[model samples]
Target: MLWAGTAKADYRDSIAVLRIGLVETHVAATDPIKLEAIEHAFSGALGIPVEIIKLGSYAALIDAHASGRVGYAIHSARSFAATEAACGCVRAFRSPVAADGSTGFRSVLVARDSVTLPVAELKVGYSSEASISGWQIPHQAMRAGSLDLPKLVRAGSVGSVIELYQAGEIDGFFGWLPDVPGDAGSDPERLFGGWNRAAIETADPVRIIWSSQRIPYGPHAANRSLPDDLVEALGAFLDQMAVSAPGLLDIFEPVYGGGYVTPDPEEYHNIRGLVEALSDRKSAARIP
Candidate 1:
């Protein structure tokens, strides 16, 4: 039976029947039967009865997590950050690595030519304030660096941002580059994302002038209220699945097929800060 009840008196006891929560938006593309099979496989691997709970929205999932109604959750980076800010009661044990050997992507300022201008003097095009790579991450990075803010032009879309840069309307545009850790942007094989495509196709040479810290992929996190042993078992199961059970790995995380790895405690620090800042802004806006 699906467990959607309120938090138990002792959250530790709730793990008797492990419940994994995910939002419908995250799994809407997957088949229900496959999800059921995945649940069964997870139960077998972890040696416990596992139920996959699908919430209507992230808000509900966050509330459920905060209340200890859900022991574990599959969260997008933003949602995970919001959850962390809400309760400080969960920890991400494992995060997916991209097939390209990247843990995540970084927001970068790609210029038509080598940029020698001060950040405040350069006109940079961004897709929108809502875009993580195009505006939010890069904007936060600039503020953290104590650099004077650049002249940000809203281009509405990545394509438009590229066009504005090409037309000389903006000196550069905010885009993303794969976060391959040690490997700099020199490796042609590691290139990914829309901006990389623009750099390749455009006749003019484009160079990445600035980049933000790696923004990790969404993580599979567990509520700290659960028993430590349980969390470790779940982490082990996922971490080893790419080799022991490739099919289940594909079913569980189709997009990032490289496998799961233990998350660096600081992996989501920047994102959490960003979420808290945004939350504060909204709260301030709501005040009279």
Candidate 2:
């Protein structure tokens, strides 16, 4: 029986195999290839045979982590908080730096050039109700005014939502804007880059009307049920990768930068609070 994450030096000697859970993200389509590289890098570096488990959703991944079916997982800070709150999974390390050499990302509300902000009501698109960047954070920002979530179209992914908006299928869409330079601070234009920037510069432009608070980089979380020795070893291996094998970290979808670091629980304090607040709001709204 392979009791995952219990090996010492030569993992082959133990019946245990290292099972790594990858959080499915916008880049999920390429997970198999990325995870293959990850398996090779980690197995070679740590002498442990690794098995990669790709989960389809954050909720599914979190449930698996809580049940011990997953030994470790990659997740956004919001997901990390939720997992910790639910199953005591703790952050093993911070993800590599993103584009713009920052460790944080932001969410934005974008619309066709014809649309403007503070419009009383218009069709809006969201990735999913559970998405931190696509829904939760953006929803919190919208709640500051007359924006009502129920009126928002629940598009499946950031790309899909943006597509609907571009096609004039929706008025605006909430989506993640990666690599927002921390130095840019609250500058709206600087924060809008990548495809959004392209749209802004092109003939048919898009407007970034709202930007969410900076979200800390995602984290690598370890299940609490794993042995202490294995946990320490995993951390050590990650630290080694941060220094010695950074390219392998491309699997994490870091937009701008790369390199792991010890995660500070304090880094996620604000995000956790925001998530809790949103949860409370949802529960309250559900009371009929």
Give TM-scores for every candidate, taking all chains together and pairing residue i with residue i. 0.86, 0.64
Cα displacement (Å) at residue 208, model 2 = 8.8
Question: In candidate 2, what are the lDDT values of residues 1-288, reduced to their tens digit?
Answer: 576866644435552677777755645335567767877876776577778787788878878777778778887677788777775656545465654666676777766667654544767888788687777776665565534443578888766775676677787767666543436544435423455554434334556666666667877777766666666677787767645776765544454345666666677775776667867888999999
Query: Considering every candidate listed, which one attains the maximal lDDT?
Result: 1
Where does candidate 2 clash, by residue pair? 98-256, 98-257, 99-256
Looking at candidate 1, what is the lDDT of residue 285? 100
Tens digits of per-residue lDDT for model 1 on 1-288? Answer: 456676644423555688888788764324788778878888887777888888888888888888889989998888888888899999999999888788888877766666678778998888989888788888787777744588889999877876776677888777787776677744322324543464445635667767777888889999988888788888889988999989888878878889987888788988888898899889999999
Q: What lDDT does model 1 reach? A: 0.79
Name the lDDT of candidate 2: 0.66
